[model samples]
Target chain A: MSRGDWASWLESWRQQLVLWLESTPAGDFVNTYTWAWPIAESFHFVGLCLLLGTVGLFDLRLLGFARQIPLPQLHRLIPWGIAGFSINAATGSLFMAAAPFQYLYNESFYFKATFLSVAGVNVAVFYLLFYRKIVPLGAGEQAPWPARIIGGVSLLMWIGVMCAGRLLTFYRPSFRFF
Target chain B: MDPVFIWLEQTALSVWVRESPSMFAFPGILTLHTIGMAFLVGLTSAFSLRILGFARRVPAPEMLKLVPVVWFGFFLNLVSGFLLLLAYPTKALTNPVFYLKLTTIALALLAVRALGRRVADLSFRPVRGWPGDRVLASLTLGFWVVSVTAGRFLAYTHSRLLASDF
Candidate 1:
């Protein structure tokens, strides 16, 4: 529970993770092939667009942008957003596997993870708590304050996730301590 | 071309874009570019999906209001993209992929504009008509994929980093 204990634990885990990941097939594929990295990066960009397009637009509607689109109707696009998220998750894991240290201690990566978590929790809350409430509302009707707040937060969180993700390379951590 | 790039690169704005330690410089501009891509491609993709019958309950007309937002995304990218180009005139100017990216973006913008009209008096049924809705939707999606991919490839494909390198 002390600072020293936590630091040591992190240090050991980082070493183990790096060692394990370096030996992975995903790691080998990425490391062996020249095109692997760029290919994955391309897919990652596409997936993010898909996500922001469907889900982000829905979020905008909830925030009263283009209020004419019915909430329930617009909700249909969430599945595509899920598909986009799935692609990114797969490619993102590959990236992290290929170069574990690039992300493990990077401040941008940490911020990205935090924003991703916030977005995830925000989605759950929207569906469980606010989704059904907005369902009955028809075209041009304004969403309740809760829905609007959730929408605003969702947008901000996604934008945060994106900004953090984009800044990952700029904030690559130094391994001098190791 | 090299002379112009050299001149541009030597400008204070371009220098800051390339060498500044501030996050608002290259890092922030790139982040803004990503956000623009998300919104530009995102809103249009949403509209395109609706056109493709992904969301049947939603009236296609209701979604047209968001087109301006899509344009807003394009505007953001245009400014951020120019700033990016300003930062590295030689890198982009020297690469064939850069031209591909610009052309692809131009095509994609056309597709977006055409879709606007095609969806104006839209119908869901398979009607034999001029520039089918599904076709335009598919084109928009396809053009975007190419543009986004080409945009990413621009980073790796550039042979020259600066005019001075020549």
Candidate 2:
């Protein structure tokens, strides 16, 4: 199909998806409670702190900032970061479930998803390509060039994620764009 | 204070922040505030985790390297937060939750300072079982939780969106 056709097709698909999402059980729960949405948002911000603190710190270590900390040891904080991500994923889903069309059609949602995917790919690259090689490095040692590069990319991607996430509300789709 | 909030809200900077259609205005400031919160709370949590013995092999003093990052996030939030308040002075100032958030942050920062002092004073010792240090770390973590929660609720609990709106 041509680009215009594809775009319109996707737009129609999104409208249908939004309608289905609005009928889900989670959507009802989120919309019915006066405080539920705000509470979920509170948890989301808290989770963000946890994720950034642990994951961002590890990234800094890779870039040679905290030279005295062992890489393996510092890596222990990753679970907390994962916990943060989990909280965000849950809360984020609730937001989408509450008003599917808002995010389904929002440009900022697309940016946030793109950044999130980039971060996922960066993590895969780190573990699949370089984790074994860089794991044995001790405190005060410089990570390999590849590790440093991964660290830099991870930082940028996560920052992009934060920026895009914050921009979500601003880009609530008005349905006119579709 | 009422007059002050009213006056502040009318300033060109504040008016632009509230009224501008550009994403660079309110949205950008909020984005900066959130990014800062993540780093500030996240880096601090890492230090607390170390004090609580999650990563025993990491020398405690080495974690001090992250203090600068914590400060960087804190300052970023301070500036961005001020801009947000400038944009909607009455909205935040009238909300009790906003004050709670500020108080929580102040305590959290103090906890951070206390933890940093203990970490700096360590003679490169393993920080596995220091009861006092652990307490400080735990308090810092708890305060950050409260701060983030209160900050989040500011959007929901505000009684007024503008000086005259209420």
On TM-score, the leading prediction is: 2
Candidate 2 overall lDDT versus native: 0.88
Q: Model 1 off-target regions past 4 Å?
A: A175-178, B121-131
B125-163, model 2: which lDDT tens digit per residue? 765738888898899999999999999888888988777
lDDT of 1: 0.87
Q: How far is each candidate from the true structure, as Cα RMSD in Å?
A: 2.1, 1.7
Checking candidate 2 for backbone clashes, the offending pairs are: A53-B42
Error of 1 at A103 (Å): 0.2
lDDT of 1 at A147: 79
Candidate 1, pairs of clashing residues: A53-B42
**TM-score (chain B only), all candidates:** 0.91, 0.95
TM-score of each: 0.95, 0.96
Predicted model with the maximum lDDT: 2
Per residue, candidate 2 scores C-alpha lDDT tens digits across A1-178 of 9999999998788878888888889989999999999899989988888888888898999998889888878888899999999999999999999988788878889999999998899999999998887678788877789888899988998899999988999988776754
| Whole-model lDDT per candidate | 0.87, 0.88
